[model samples]
Target: MKRLFAVMLIILLAGSMVFAGGKKESGTIKIAVAGPHSGDLASYGLPTVKAAEIMVEKINAEGGLLGRQVELVIEDDVCKPEVATNTAAKIVGEGVVAVIGHICSGATKAAMGIYNDSKILAISPSATNPALTQSGDYPNFFRTIASDDAQARIEVDFALDTLGLTKIAVLHDKGDYGKGLAEFAQKFLEADSRAEVVLFEGVTPGAVDYTAVINKIKNSGADGIIFGGYHPEASKIVSQMKKRAMDIPFISDDGVKDNTFIKVAGDYAEGVYASGPMDTTTNPLTIQATKEHQEKYGEDPGAFYLNAYAALQAVFNAIEVAGSTDYDAVTNALRTSYVETTLGKIKFDSKGDAEGVGFSMYQVQNGVYVELK
Candidate 1:
């Protein structure tokens, strides 16, 4: 009986040592990929999640961070604000090491408080609303993309100087990102005094038909349209404009830069311009990432998938710098460190915004998208 008792005690101690970190040492760590996985904005959401998957695969092949493979826990929030808040709570509950999303600005904003309180780190690939990082409230939130206001400035300059269109109309989806970016451009345009914004309007998102809004844009007699919304609606508006024979050029903020935009608008999308933060085709790292992405998924990467890959790069780099899983330590490391990513060198400032921000312009020509000098 004494011999049996000693053997049992030794087995229990070994098991305890393996699980001492509150989970089995299975050589795996669970992170989250949260966003609109099943809805219209899934075009925006899917890219980041898929990118995270690809990144994890690569890192695992090279012996993942600290010898633990990354396992993504996907949760779909449908890009709804309330759903996002709920999703954040669930992610935190799952004890995920970090999140790669809450893809839209509204979703990020709604979930920010929960993430902040829980000390759950979140890095969005596409949420560009300034408040997500500018408010200084979401210490745990970070993003790979530039703020909407930053993109708006470049877009406004192009509309006035390059397009030489003095009369412009601003349209938004009324969500946090759309409205904020639209108003940011309008505010700057208002200050310019050289350009005149003839109309400012908001369109209800997820609407099947926007002929009413389309007619409004046509009748506005504006020389250009600046849209602060996603691709689906922007495609409809531009397609309708084509049918109405309105040839004025319109520029879209990054939200509508996906290939789905061209697919939705078809031939009508020709000559329409969209702005993005980085061009994956040109960046050497992005070229490799894109090639790997295509080989794994059997399709070209989404418009912003590189940014998502960069987000993972940022998150993993921070974890490596921190050297531990403690929330505050990891959070502080992210806040203060400059991490190199596929997006080039990325460093977060005091407000948790990425430094060295800029935008790239893209236009649909000959039924394909290409970077505009």
Candidate 2:
């Protein structure tokens, strides 16, 4: 009887030790990385995931935050708003300290309500629709990239003052970012600038042919065309225009600025101009990081990935300043913190938006994106 009691006590103590060890391991500082990991837009999402992975690795290697290794919990929102909301809820349920994604503006907007309700701090690296920051309810939401309004203002200046374009046609994909940017540009061009939007229309995203739209623009007698959409749709439109012998200069927002656009559009991408915050290729740090990324991953990093890296840095900086994993504390710290990231110094305004940054214009030459003056 004595031996049996001793053995039972030993078993109970061993079980208690196992449970305690599990609890300690589970005390990880989890940062959720949500994006369209599996979709036609996977190129955009995958790079963000890779960037977050790199950031986590770097953070962990340096003894991590608050003496605990950072852990990344990535979720695929598939670039859909509903999926994004669900993913945000799941991340919150998993007790992640913060979130760094839902790359598309629509997805970010969808998840905003949940994040706000849950008091989870979410910083988007790529979502650029003006509404996300301007919306009054999203106090916990933040974005690293400049808004479409800024991009539009810069592109409009280039179109009128630099390119000397008088008449232009604006086309958009009808997505949140696309339509927001197109409408914003149109308003600015018509009201503030000498440029006239001769033709404005929405195109169905993922359509293989845009011959009808191209013909409309051709007949509209516009000297230039601005497309507000991603590379896939923009490439198809440009390629189709080439088939129709449309020689009008093509301009686009950052959505269409990617190497994949050049590859898909082939020679047609040459002379295509795009406006965004300076391309990652132009930044020395980004250039070196791209080389390292290529060496490690066998491919160059995408534009959004660099933005994600900056966003992650901002979040971690806020975490360190707050000195605790509490979401509200970190959120407050983010608003008050001055973080120097890959994009330079970042300071947020009351609206949770970056301040006083300008956009850079780039043009494709010989299948490579080069910054244009």
Candidate 3:
């Protein structure tokens, strides 16, 4: 009896010690790839996942980063601000050295506070709200995309100077990204003496119908419309406009500049103009990246695919340059070191925007988006 009791006590002590030590670290370096992995915005986030997977596979094949195999921790936020805070907390809890997403502007804005507090470096491929970096609130935040201010200038200039439009309706989806962009569009149009903004409105996302707003746009006698929302809302509005014979030119921002929008809007998408990351088709790196994606996925890469690929390249390169994942060192290296990516050789500017990254106007023609010359 005494021998048995002593054996039981020893086993219990060993179990308690293991429990007290918490999760044991694996040999691989863990990086979180977070975004709206499911939901309507899944199309936007899944490409980043594939980009990271391909990049990591290439990295490991090249002997890995810092001689350690890299692992990914993917999380889904569904592009909601409320869900994003929780996702951010979960990523911090997972002991990741860095993060690659929180794709939407509102979600990215929500997650940055947590990342800043935890000292984790986060580089977003598509979060473009100016305040995310310009406000000086998130020192740990960086992105590979240009901000909306630049995009808005391109859009307004295209409308007034290129297309010769004088009166326009500016509309948004009532979300952080959509409304913020619409506000900038309104500001620029109001500043331009050649144009007049006939209407500025925000519509509820996922509504069954947008007839009310369509009526407003028609009644305003606007010769053109500028949309500040994603493809889902944009497609619905454009489809409705076409159905009503309101054939004025529809201009939109990067949010609407997606193949999914073209698919959803069908023939109505014809001649719709939107601004997106400038065409990099001529870049050799881009050609190689596209080829790799085609071979791996058996399909054309989706929206923001190259931008996401560039983000991973930038992050891993920064880690290599800094020699460690120290937050200050990695971020400093990001701002100082240039990495050749699908976007060409680029580095982060002081405000976290990617240098040499800018927007270009595109039009949906014959079932595909064609870059305007």
Cα deviation of 170, candidate 3, in Å = 11
lDDT of 1 by residue, 130-153 (tens): 778878888888888888688888
TM-score of each: 0.63, 0.63, 0.64
> What is the Cα-based TM-score of model 2?
0.63
TM-score of 3: 0.64
Q: Which sequence of candidate numbers ranks them by lDDT, best first?
A: 3, 1, 2
Error of 1 at 188 (Å): 5.0
Comparing 1 with 3 on lDDT, the higher-scoring candidate is: 3
For model 1, the superposed segments whose C-alpha errors exceed 4 Å read: 1-21, 24-27, 154-182, 185-280, 360-373
Give the top-scoring candidate (lDDT). 3
Q: Lowest lDDT 10-mer window, candidate 3?
A: 19-28
**Which residue runs does candidate 2 get wrong by more than 4 Å?**
1-26, 155-182, 189-276, 279-282, 356-358, 361-373
lDDT of 2 at 2: 100
lDDT scores for all predictions? 0.84, 0.83, 0.90
